[model samples]
Target chain A: MRVAAVVKRIAKQFKRDRRSLALMMIAPLFVLTLVWLVLDGDDYEPKMGYSEMPQPVIELLDEETQHLEQYKKEEAIDLMKDGELDAFISIEGMTPTTLLEGSEPSVNSAVMRVIQESLKSLKTNTQIEEPTINYLYGSGDMNLFDRVGPVLIGFFVFFFVFILGGISFLRERTQGTLAKLLSTPIKRWELVTGYVAGFGLFTIIQSVVIVAFSIYVLDMYMVGNFVELLVVTILLAITALSLATLLSSFAKNEFQIMQFIPIVIIPQVFFAGIFNLETLDRWIQILSQFMPLTYGAEALQQMMIKGAHIYDVWFEIMILFGFALVFFILNIRVLKKHRSL
Target chain B: MSFINVKHVSHAFGKEKVLEDINLTIEEGKIFGLLGPSGAGKTTLVNMMVGILSPDQGEITIDSTKVPSFDLMNITGYMAQSDALYQELSAKENLEFMGSIYGLKKSELKERIQHVMKTVNLLPHLDKPVEQYSGGMKRRLSLAAALLHQPKLLILDEPTVGIDPVLRKEIWEEFRELQQQGITIIVTTHVMDEADKCDELGLLRDGQLMAKGSPGELKEQHHASSIEEVFLTVGGVES
Candidate 1:
């Protein structure tokens, strides 16, 4: 009964503070859209400059490259230095040598693909058939946005819920409401449960809105069940909420809550499958195991990108549940500082 | 037997002692004021009585039940020094939340909320958000919340710091009426004139109880003109 009162009060507070509600619902969508606009572009077409090439070779290279230009050795080097050319190919001792302007990895790969394809045909002295490309999971049409979309969904849900939940709990202390609450007959567990159920409702709605918008409006790649995606996102949110309330015990105010972004939130993004962690040191890869977002983002990616079923990602789901439970228990323990009972 | 017994209670925060070896008692149906300046541990001592804080070295009991107990908390109403209200919530909403936490039934809570709001003279502005309320109005609302559950013991810390003189007197009248109904009230204040109104006063200075007595008895015992002079006399002797 006491928990119900707390939940109802939080609902009323959210209704009155429309701006915070909007921030939790709309801010993630805004950032996701911006990222999509920047990352969803077509693959890069590198500009290639060649000199002293045979007529037959020039024709073959012209067919392979989109922006093929003829230039003297000196002029091609000048263009490459000026950043106008991606690569320059010239024959030296009857062997083709290539000079690449290699700042961006993607652009470098694109240039190599074009040069390698034309040179392969030249070296074989016959036109070889293209190998049939097949995909076991995501198709060839998947873009950078599709690959990182699930991770972003997980990240935003975790980020916003953490900030909102942490600050609200901290306010209860700084404003003396927490001390006043401890004076009442309410039990410690009841208060913590009230916070979880209260914030849990909003996070459910938040998960639904963000997931629907990403799949329907933004056309993000989704090969999994909508309901399963929501399950992962909501569990991730609960984990974030519990962790946030637990940490709020140590913070004195809102700015201190924000200080957690660098120390807590950002590192998870790097290790949560948004970036490649396989090439990192073994110890660095092991660090990701401790972060809750790593499990959430991993589960989300498996479901959305690999089209895995709920049973397939049960391990990740259980890990997230464990994190929430541990944090929730710690929250109740932290309240013992205010009132031992 | 005394209604409230604070026996050998001593508390410290980190290295600074806030209350030291304090022994005090209050009868049922009396207005007991803790008279002291700021940092005199008045708030700390009252917090221990309300179960918000546990004494490091001693035990406090109300009606023979040790405090820091849920049963005692259910019967005690505490008004903190800070307003401690949800600024975005209306006065009605804040009272309703607190009333329900005390397990007040729906119909009874509504009636009690209205009664308490009337007692504090804030009935008309009950629906107004607390953020819009003036400082005095917020203090009154906090008092109304404490009174909503109809507790037998009321512990108020500086309840009238921002209220005007006219309203302060009116509040004191309401306190008397509550006392008449056999409610035990504990008020902490530095106001000398207000100390004279209590049935008993515990004069505290630097975390020590310099003296404890009825306002008249304290003055006569020290051969002082008023409770303020008595405070200075006892405080001077201790120093």
Candidate 2:
């Protein structure tokens, strides 16, 4: 019953603070849209320049490169230096030598792909059949946004909930409401539980809106059940909320809560599978195991990209639950500083 | 035994002793004031009485029940030196939230909220968000919230600091009305005139209780004309 009052109060407060409400609900979607615009573009077609090349190779290269031009070797080198040409190819002693701008890794790979495709055709006299590709989960059309979309969703939910919950809890202490509350008959666990229940209600709605918008409106890749995805996201948010309120016990004000961003939130983003961690040092990869977002983002990726079932991600779900439970207990323990009972 | 007994209560924060060997008692149905300047440990002592803080050396009990107890908490209302209110919430919402924490039922909470708001003379602005309220109005709202649970003991820490003289007088009257109903009121203040209005006053200086008595008795004992003179005389002797 006491928890209900706290939840109702939080709901009423959220209604009054429209700006924070909009920030939680709409800001992530807005940022995700920007990321999609930047990441979900068509594959790059490198600009290629050739001088004294065979007609057969030129025809093949022409088919691969979107912007192709024939120029003198000096002209091609000048264009490459000016960043106009991605690569320049010329025949040197019957073997084609290529000079690349070599500044951008993505552009470098694109230029290599066009040159390799054209050269491979030239090496084989007989016509080669194109290999048919098949995907177990995502299709060939999957873009960078599709791959990172689930991790970003988990990250934003964790980030926003941490800030909002931490500050609100800290405000309770700084404003003296917490002292007033400690003077009341309410139990310490009830207060902590009330906070979780209160913020949990809002995070559920936030997760639903963000996940649905990402998959349906933003056209993110989703092969798993929508409801399963929400379960992971909501669990991630609750973990974030509990951790935030627990940390707020140490902070004196909102600015101190912000100090947690670089130390707490940003590191989780890097370690939460937003970037591939396979090639990183073993200890760095082990560090990801300690972060709650790592499990959440991993579960979300398994579900969205690999079409994993609920049971497949149950371990992640249990770990997220354990993190939240530890934080919730620590919150109750911290309240003992104000009131022993 | 008196209704409230604070026995040998001494509390310190790190090396700075905030309250030293403070011993006092108050009977039921009376207004007792702790008079002190800022950092006199009036708030620290008040917090112990309200069960928010525990004394380092001794214990406090109300009506024979040791404090920091939930049962005692149910009957004690506390208003801190700072107005502890949610700025985004309306006056009604703030009261309702506090009332529910005491486990007040829906109908009773609604009725009690109305009664307290009316007592504070803030009924008309009950729906206005506290952010729009002036400092005095917020202070009154905090008082109203403390009174909503109908606690048997009310501990108010400088409750009238931001209020104007007229409202302050009215609030004192309200305190008296509650006192008439057998509720014990403990008010801490530095205002001399307000100290005189208390049924009994305890003069605190530098973390020690310098004197404790009724206003008239204190004046007569010290051969002083006013409560301020009595305070100065008591403090003078101690220093």
**For residues A1-341, what per-residue lDDT tens digits would candidate 2 score against the true structure?**
88888889988999999998998999999998999899999989889999888788899998888889998988988988888899999989978899899999999999888888888867676777878999888999999999999999999999999999999999999999999999999888888888888888999999999999999998999999999998999899999999999999889889999999999999899988988999899998999999999999999999999999889989999999999999989989988888877
Clashing residue pairs in candidate 1 (N, C-alpha, C atoms within 3 angstroms): none
- lDDT against the true structure, per candidate, is 0.93, 0.92
* Tens-digit lDDT string for candidate 1 (A1-341): 99999999999999999999999999999999999999999877788898887777777778766689988878888888888988998999979989888898999998888777677656665567778999999999999999999999999999999999999999999999999999999999999999999999999999999999999999999999999999999999999999999999999889999999899999999988899899998997999999999999999999999999889999999999999999999999989988989
Off by over 4 Å in 1: A55-66, A124-128, B237-239
Could you tell me the interface RMSD of model 1? 0.7
- Write candidate 2's Cα lDDT for B210-234 as tens digits: 9999999999999999998888788
Interface Cα RMSD for candidate 2?
Answer: 0.7
| Each candidate's DockQ | 0.89, 0.87
Which prediction has the highest DockQ against the true structure?
A: 1
For model 2 chain B, give the 10-residue run with minimal summed lDDT. B230-239
